[model samples]
Target: MGGGVLGTMHAWQAVLRGHEVIHLEREPEARGASVRNFGLVWVSGRADGEELETALRARELWAGLGERVPGLGFRANGSLTVLRTEAELAVAEVFAAGPDAAARGTRLVDPAEARTVNPALRGAFLGALWCERDAAVEPRVAQPALRAHLAATGRYTWLPGREVREVDARGVRDDHGDHHHADVVLLCTGAALSGLVREIAGPVPVRRVRLQMMQTEPLDEPLTTSVADGDSLRYYPAYRGVELDALNANQPQPAVAAEHAMQLLMVQRADGGLTVGDTHGYDEPFPFDVVEEPYQHLRQVAEAILGRPLPPVRRRWAGVYAQCRDTGQVVHRQRVADNAWLVTGPGGRGMTCSPAIAERTVEEIGL
Candidate 1:
């Protein structure tokens, strides 16, 4: 039973259902992709059908939960995928014209309208694709806030710095040789795929993805909505249209961006700083050091979009998360034992869909 967003969500689901919960974490707090992310409850770019449905439901649940837990700092800020070139705008138009575009709350806006939506976006973009369903929260405080709420219920116990070494159908034992019993056991480990996780899910069809990101000092202006560049079209599945194919064929990403598999996703934090990212690395044996080239490219692209210099760099880091290699599966979930379940490999969808995933798990187990 991990204590990342996924694990916390599972615990929240059970506690909401009136089940006494015992949450365990290996570290003093979650220091994984959950907190390293943009704290984005992104709904528009999810793959269609089941994935999209899950994202939508999760978005709704997040809003409701945010109200209950005020410290989440949830805001329905929406998002803008700004298009700089005619080719990128063409792809956005095609995506906007799709059958489910309206259902996804997607619309194409002219440059003027894009600026109107987010004044901080002073760059001269051709246009932008807007997704009103997108939202954000304070990732740095989300876990502790949720835990505080759960603790108030007098039915939740948080055991931090406890690494689960052994798990059985009945319960689990931590590294300190302590055994805890529970009627049901759920393992929501984010990216740690060793020991019990490996023993149960042998040679899992999951791979790790590494990414680098950086945050800036407080900005002079506010980024009302999260932002993404045209390069994001290659990363998100929702843009897999004929126009996207043409755009990809005709206009490729810049050398440095392509080499690092980079995308520009920027969001403003509660402190008025901006969280910007990121580049993807999927090969095994990820580099021990974060490369500077990706960060340089990101800063250059971000400055161009803002039409101003970025704030001084405040923090830089890298995060890795498990992703299902099989594209068909939303996440790798399996019943590893009689009363034990392993739910991991949500990839980047973890932050966006964890709430709904946990809700489904509770229903499936009749908790």
Candidate 2:
């Protein structure tokens, strides 16, 4: 029952198609994976298969939405895939050599140029896979705007704090004993998909991956582009195979940071505060508690890369996502039955990929 990115994305596309869309959620507003995320609109840090096209198309949709829905954190600041190892560099190379990679604005960069773009990266990374077309948003600020836009759409009826208890062949029955109907029903439950949708019942291979992230106090300096390193690739399926294979293979032992699959993705806010993170955990039933180890690891990475410990952590927390079995990215038409569908398992690429997934869902329904 996430009314955050995917729900809003669905509402955006549905309204545009002149379809009446009722978005239901257990929370009054979105504060799940949509808000508890880096908000990096990553196009390149996506799977290299079918999602490539969806990401590309959704990118266009994001840009278009910016015209009417301003301040949705849709900045085109691009992304920098920091390469700290040979394997990471190799993955970047493959992405660059692959078809459509260049078009997506993925390019290999030298250390000098990389430093020129992000001075904080000095001496830490060898180079980076630069995605000049990527973008980011402040989740806190962006969610409000997205919510407002969806609300403004007359075709949209938001049912926040309303839990859907069951779904028969007809529609949904909520906890309040209120029944709502729709011609089609799509589950966007993130990690709770299996529990929410009975069709795919019983321990859907979706496991909850908890990640601890932190935001720094006001910084004198901030990285302009979003940045992630080898640990990021190993954890995020998007950048896993592209350029880091060789580097991951050579490491005699998994790097300590690798254990957490930690990566430093820094995004600067308008006020100069930087949001950085994150450490991955295969915590079952979703981890609401934030651990100190990840926070310590985050500091260590920042110190190693920037040659200094970052400012105080203004905010610290953990987020969870339902990871898919195969590609790790969510797919449309997950069920053969026309009305039933699955939209979870986005890994950490929800912000970048949700727009496309919602658009494709609209397309699939002939909206």
Candidate 3:
């Protein structure tokens, strides 16, 4: 029922299968985690097996969609996880040598090679772990562009600014007093977990995560690939090896970074501006204000990696998304009614795996 990436992708899958679709959005435009993210179709750091498979399939689907929808701005530029310390480099070595590392396109590059790949990164890092499967898209335009493409099919109808007030086995009723009926209904609500969702899902086994990020003015040069710091080793499941444990145990994160659960993921946009960020917050009663400490730490780490001062900050914001507490499950999907389903809690994997997730749903439900 929601119109974020997940919802839009579900609509795309259904309409492509010759099914009529009606998409609903609470906001005039999607301004949630979908738009607030790095537009990264990251496939490198996913957990092995099913999660990695989903990410890989989604990466291919994203490339295909980008070709059909020019506005998608998809790029197979890949990603580089910069390593500064010897410990971090050790972790990268282990990751590159793992059994599935070849499948993930994992490679280790020296500082010179890393710079050759992305000259914008002139920082003095030991080396970087390269993953060729990672990619990027223009999240700011993705949903609307997809919606526009779907609308051209004549079988898709978009209803924005319609907050679903009630949902039943037959259909859903919006706040505008309009009733829409469909054979199946999928609620792709992002982090809006209250009212109808709370009543139906009944204490979703998912937790909400809050994060802060910032964007800067266009840079003088391009960042050829998405970049991440060693801190990412702790956050991504793929790097949970003994080397990473040693690195984490030996080299604790800086106080400011640790305090905010910060990680440095930098990506250059189509316009040359850098999208950098992210500090994690999982507790309820999230702070109402964005603290400056995390931003300052991010700036320092970024400049050290780039070997240049970052451009002046142009925007700053915070976002929240539901993540499944059961790490084994990709997302929390429940049949709230005979024909109504609540699909959510993909966590940070939402953008990376939405297309594949929706495709699986269609297959399972025979939609």
Candidate 4:
């Protein structure tokens, strides 16, 4: 049982199927990766095939949900992975000419065209890889908004502050010593993979990923579209190819950037502040804190792109998300019992693919 985006989306799907759902969460409110993200329905760099398909479907779902729940703040703003160097441009050119370009709504735009798409990018740039399929929603508010929509149907009950301690074929028992009966139990837990998850399915194949993220005060102007620096070409899978390999060989990140696995993904919030991030930390025993080096690097890159200094930093934080070790599996879904299942390890795709992931889980389980 969980109450994050994946779990909330599961509840939404079940209620849509005429099932009375009782969603449970350990915390009174979600204080995890779900809220601590860029709120990006990012489709620009998803690995092709299943991952990309799931993201496209989820983007559609989020758009539809936005119509029903205004608080979702869903927007088809798309994204511009700004490319400054010739190497980054080369990778984007290859991707723009790829077979999946049309499917991903991808295009390579010149500097003039890119500026038209997002005028806030006043800084110099070679070009940009634009993906019109990309979208965004307010991560901090999405779950509560979705839950409110589910509640409107009178088929959903949100039970936060109740951690499931036991699971069986019939139902689950909460930490408060209360048992709730159900026909089937879908454990959509996020990164808390120990305790009940371990008891039910043992150790999972997924690994916990930690990342550092931050938000700015407020930009005087609108960002218009989500933005990414050239470093993204190295991190996202869609750009993987010989061209990328050459680029990587010829242009490696600086020491601090390379050390932290850093990338610049900036999205403007509804309030005008920009949400920027992120550095990947895969090793276990992740630091329980944020470091200044990555943030400094991010600031330098972001300012270089915008040709202006960013507003004062208002918030800085670290979040941990579960990602499948076997990069091939979109998500790890395990049958823990006769009528119980465990689902998690969506990785960064959690926000972008949650709606579609939950939909697939329902179909597979015949829910």
Candidate 5:
């Protein structure tokens, strides 16, 4: 059991089914990847088949949930992956013309057209891949907001500052020496795969991914929509093809970008500050510190796209999220016991796909 978005979403699902729910969290509040994310209900980069379908379904669920919970700060602002080079545009062209492009709300637009969709992008670019299905929410507050809504149903109990130390077919025992019995138990632990998780479900297929991000002071203008640099083409899956391969070979990312596996994905907050990031790292024993080179590269790419200076960066941080090493798997859900299930490893899709993941979990578990 955890207090991140995954845990909260599972709680929401059970409450929706009119079940009495007791939610246990290790922290007083969620402070993991769930809160430390871009708050994106991203659907543009999901791989085809199950992954894409899950993201689309989650997008629909998020829209409805956003309406119910105002603090979710959900916006159908869509996204524009700005392309500055012919190579990047080629990838977008292939993707936009692909069979599922229509389903993904994807389109290739000229610079003028892209600017019309998001006027803050005064910087020069060849074109952009517009994804109308992409959306945003305020990540930091989403969990608590959803929990509050669930509490109103009079069947939800939130017990934070308590960690579940043991689980069996009957129930769980917390670190406080208290025993809480239940008919079913779901562990939505985020990235903590040791101790209880390992003891109960040894050697899971998940790995941790570290990423760095920053939030700047409010910009004078609105971002209108989330924005991405062409480097994102190399990161997202839908762009894979002969054209993408050629683009990768012909126009490799800059030295700093390649070294960090960096991508520039920026979204505006309710207060107008821009959330910018991120670089990928998978090696174990992750650095306990944040590096400056990646931040410098992110600022450079973001400013280049906006044609203006970013507001002063007020904060910077790093987050580690669990991911399935298989890359194509949406999430890792396993029944560790007759009545207990262990679910984790959503990666970057945690925020985008948690709602649907929880829905599917409850359905499969017959909750």
Candidate 6:
């Protein structure tokens, strides 16, 4: 019943494979973690070497999808991880000095050199690790474009506001007392995964994690590229220098160093608006609470980093991403009944990670 990037991407993949598909979404409008995200089609944080080969291919797929689905809000602004401390600089050096630096387009640059690439960052930080391969898109703009493409595909059959209750070996049962049958079935429900679903797939260990994010009004000069702090190394998977054990032992400091927020500021839209602030927090089961105090903390950190109060708030929200314990992205196969299957759990990387994941799922089904 939870339909977002994973669900939609699977729908698109079905059409590509010449399989007739029916997409059921319970929500009147598709607005949640899937659309309310950084919208970054990222490859920088991909696992090292062979692990990244698939992510690299998905990067190209996003570009091709943009062409096919015009107004998909694709941008090639690239991403820069700014280093404010000597320790941060050393970490960036390690990444640049690593074996995959060339193909990843990662380089260490001095402050002055970074300003040349993003003039808005003039006199802002000590240095940055630039990755030209990363890009972004406007989620608000892209979702509708995707919907329209699916509508035009003729291969797609969408049933909005319809919630699926059960999926037996034969077909899917909805709340409206109807059942839709298909040769194969895939479940892309995010955060709502539980019960026998886990029993069926061994244990993918799905959990709903909420991220606090904020947006700003248009500014006079927008940053040409995305910017993040060295502390981001601890939070993002791409920064291999961050060890899981090391981070769990560490916590937010007395005044909230820019690192604790793991903030990645990106100048977005033609109007000069910027989207910033992302903090990860999790509870035992799952909490969908959207609070304001986190934004207050976020603003404090932004002021500390920018040396000034942030611009007027434009939009504010919280979204949940389904995570499968320590996995890059969750892709599972559940043989619910004889020959019938359920596939899901792509996690937060669904945007940059979905193209390849959907292709793999379709291939697995031989459709």
**Candidate 1, residue 184: lDDT:** 93
Report lDDT (CA) for all predictions: 0.91, 0.72, 0.92, 0.93, 0.93, 0.70
> lDDT by residue for model 5 over 193-215, one digit each (tens)?
99999999999999999999999
lDDT tens string, model 6, 254-335?
Answer: 3443423445455466567777767676665435565676677667655554555678989877777777664654455556
Candidate 3 local lDDT, 1-367, one digit each (tens): 8989999999999999999999999889888899999999999889988899999999989999999999989999999999999999998998887899888988999999898889889888999998989999999999999999999999999999999988876689999999999889999988888888998888888899999999999999888999999999989998897888898889999999998888999999998899999999988999999999899999999999999999999999999988999875788888888898888989999999999999998888889
Query: Predictions ranked by lDDT, top down?
Result: 5, 4, 3, 1, 2, 6
lDDT of 1 at 243: 87
**Each prediction's TM-score versus the true structure:** 0.99, 0.87, 0.99, 0.99, 0.99, 0.88
Q: Please give the distance, in angstroms, between residue 186's alpha carbon in candidate 1 and its true position after superposition.
A: 0.4
Candidate 6 Cα deviation (angstroms), residue 261: 6.3
Model 5, runs deviating above 4 Å: none
Off by over 4 Å in 1: none
Error of 5 at 150 (Å): 0.5
Which of the predicted structures, 4 or 6, would earn the higher TM-score when compared with the native?
4
- After the best TM-score superposition of candidate 2, give how far the Cα of residue 195 lies from its true spot, in angstroms: 4.5
| Candidate 4 runs further than 4 Å off | none
Of candidates 2 and 1, the better by lDDT: 1
How does candidate 5 fare on TM-score?
A: 0.99
| Candidate 6 segments exceeding 4 Å error | 49-51, 195-203, 242-262, 265-267, 285-293, 300-309, 328-330, 338-340
